[model samples]
Target: MIQRPLYINKLLGFKDKQLIKIVTGIRRCGKSTLFEMYQEELLKKGVFKQQIQSINLEDPLYRDLINWEKLYDYINAHLVDDKMNYVFIDEIQNVADFQKAADGLFIKKNVDLYLTGSNSNIQSGQWATLLSGRYVQIHVFPLSFKEYSSALSSDNKFEKFKQYLENSSFPYVLNLNNDKKQIYDYLGGIYSTVVLKDVIANKKIRDINRLESVIKFMTDNIGNISSIKKISDTMVSEGLKILPVTIENYINALCDSYILYKANRYDVKGKRLLKTLDKYYLVDIGLRYYLLGNTKTDKGRILENIIYLELLRRGYNVYVGKNGDKEIDFIAESIDGTEYYQVAETVRDPLTLKRELSSLDLVRDHNPKFLLTQDFEPNTSHNGIKQINIIDWLLE
Candidate 1:
């Protein structure tokens, strides 16, 4: 099994804490695997096998314990007297009023509770209200480029990255050995589960065709600024009469399901967020190849999508920055301060290089600036801004 030290280290840090550890992400992004790995680590640290009680609600063996009361009683009955019990409940949302059971389990001084969910609702509404100030969420994402590269025997990172983009990054696809047909079928299964079970059924959305149209438009325009009215207008012109309100609902559902992520625009001069023309990025780029065939793609935008997700993995609040008329590709803010980024496929030409650097010039701030590209020359510095290869940056 591939080791995810990034997430595993996080779980280790929160081990045996009073807070309920909730791991969340899109479906098939390896939440279950992460739990299994962390459980193994617990055993390594002398956590006894008998003290660890794992119940996967999705498993048919636990079907009878679907109700919140029954689930609570079942786990409560298995508690090891006077010893710390590591209770892992997978897909806790399968039970109605699961927070009741979670709360019951949490109050026990000996129970170290861990839960996993595939949708955002696990932390919203009733769950959030009941578990307020009592939980710490550890969000899991699909394998990063570094993690993906670790699983391969070859040292050819550039080739592996190309394969990572074309083939799906949903973890299981790596086991298929880069077969096109197998990857297609695997990604299709994930798409259906996330759209049908997570988005449609969970949100009670009825129009599958219209929902798909919106998905296609958003997927095709990754890294581009868009709005509900613009999406509605475009679909109407294409003969699908979707209202802007319906489109907004669909977008919300998509985001809630973790199939898409929205990055709002930030006004650099005003130092505030803008409410218009927000950009959407897919959780996985291979899904884009699966939805739209492997035709010609915009390399620049694809690189931007990769960098955007990487910034998120590094724990930064990323946004598109508008400085007067020029738009900076990303403005990542964290406790350290604000950092600026500009991503492009290549800046080999002087004119292209100058155009990319101009936006950073407008920032007029002491915060670090970066220009990431695929062109691999010696890492150079234009003024104070650093220019590094995108692949090198990912490995870092």
Candidate 2:
């Protein structure tokens, strides 16, 4: 197993905090594997197996335990000893009123709680109203390029990079052979399930055709400024009658389901955030391509999407920086400092390099600014900003 140090480190830090350890992410992104890894760590530390009540709510064996009363009854019975008992519940949303049960579980000082879910409905709605700030949401993303390469165990870094970009960061892809059709089929199934179970069914959406048309438009227009009105108008042009309000709700539903992420624009000069014209990036590029076949022309935008997810994984508050009229690909900030980034397919053309660096140059701040590309040139650092190869940046 390729141990995900980042998530494990987080789990270690939040081991016995008062808050519930709520893990949220897209299905099959290794959240369950993360749970298993954490469990192994606990056991190795002398925590006995009997003390941990690991339950999969989706499992057929737990079909009878579909409500708070039954789940609470089983867990309450497991709280036998005075020692701190750890509870791990996978897909907790399968049980109705799960938040009540989870909240009730952590009330006892002898019990520590953890829950995983594929839908944001677990964090919002009833859960949010009940648990409120009593929980810490740790979003589990797909494998990063570095982690993917570790699973691949390939001698060639470039080959690993290419495979990651084309297939996706999902951990299961690591086990499959080098077959594009297999990768597509697996990702396609994941995409369909997330859309059907999480987005459409959970959100109670009735218009399937309109929702899919909007999905196609968003998938095609990755990294570009888009709004509900823009999506609605474009869909209308394609003979799909979708209202702007419907588009907004459906887009938000997809985002809540973890299929897409929206990065709002922040104005550097004005020192304020913009409400409109945010860019939506798919959770995984392979899933995006599986839904709407890959195109050679959109490779640059696809690279931008990859870098966005990486920044998110690194725990940065990332925003699309708006410098006057120019657009910076990403403005990432953390407690340590801030970093400005511009992503491009390559800087082979002088004009392209100039365009990529223009926004970063205009910013007067002394913070580190970087231009990431696929160029293999030795120009690692520019006048003030750093010009880095995308692959090198990902690995670093």
Candidate 3:
């Protein structure tokens, strides 16, 4: 196992907290593996195997325990009272009224609860409304470049990183051989499962054609600003009659599925989110490449997408930095409201470097501002703004 320390660190903090450990992510993005990793940690810390009630809800053996009452009975019968009982439920969203079971379990002080789900529609009633502030949601993503490299052979690290950019960050794809067809098939399966779990199961979206069209349109216009109206218009132009409201619902479903992320354009000078346009970034680039059948077009924008996800993984509130009229690729702020970053693919041209650096200078705040690019230059202070390579910045 690659041992994702970044996530494990968060899990360690989740130990014995009164709040439920809710891990959410796209399907097949290693939620089950993360559960296993956390389980091992608990055992290493002297937790008895008998006290840990680990259940894979998707397994057919648990078919009889589909409802909350049956699940409660099943878990209650297996409860060991000698120590703090740890409950691990994978894909808990599959069970109806799971919140009742979860909230009911938390009433017992000796139980530590951890639940995993592939979607946000996690039984909306009492568990969420009643246990509002009592739960911590941990969002997990596909493998980062760092994690992907760790799983590959040493000799092919760089080549594998490039392959990762082309294929995806999904862990299973990395374990398999780097065959293009195999990667596409694997990612396709992931996409299918996410659509089924988050879209079909949670949201009763019957128009598969319209939803798939919206996905294609969004993927094709990765870095471009788009709206539901624009998507609806484009579909009509292509001889498809879909309502703007339907398009909005489909896009919302995709967002809930964690397949596409929307970057609402923020006006840094005005300090507000713009209403008209927003950019969409696919959860993984490999899926984009698999759909497009090319990884070379608009490489800069693709690199920008990579930077966006990395900033998110690094616990930053990222936005497209708008400096008056100029557009800075990113304006990343840490969770504590400290630190900021500006990412760009290259500053090869003098004008490009000057333009990129100028955006950072526009922000009068004396916080950490950096311009990340592909150029092999060390930190160059341009009018008090630091310029660094994207690779070095990411590794940092």
Best by TM-score: 1
Tell me each candidate's TM-score: 0.97, 0.96, 0.94
TM-score of model number 3: 0.94
Pitting candidate 1 against candidate 2, the one with the higher lDDT is 1
Model 3, position 233, has a per-residue lDDT of 88
- For model 1, how does the per-residue alpha-carbon lDDT over 107-226 read when each residue is reduced to its tens digit? 999999999876556533545676899998887778888889889999899998998888867888889998999989999999999899888887888999999999999999999889
**Minimal lDDT window, size 10, model 2:** 119-128
**Model 3 alpha-carbon drift over 4 Å, by segment:** 123-127, 155-157, 338-340
Q: Give stretches of model 2 more than 4 Å off.
A: 124-126
lDDT of 2 by residue, 123-177 (tens): 4455567688898878889998889888865788898888887887889987778
Full-model lDDT for every candidate: 0.90, 0.87, 0.79
Q: Write the per-residue lDDT of candidate 3 for residues 1-396, one digit (tens) a residue.
A: 768888888988978888898888777778889989988988899988998998888899888887998998889889987678999898787788787898788888888999887655653233467468778878888888888877776765446657777778888986668888888888888878778767876888887887888888898887777887889889999999899988888888788778888787778879887887788888899888766777456777788788888888887877776668877667667656744456666778889777777777778888777777777766788776777776666666
* Model 3 lDDT at residue 28: 76
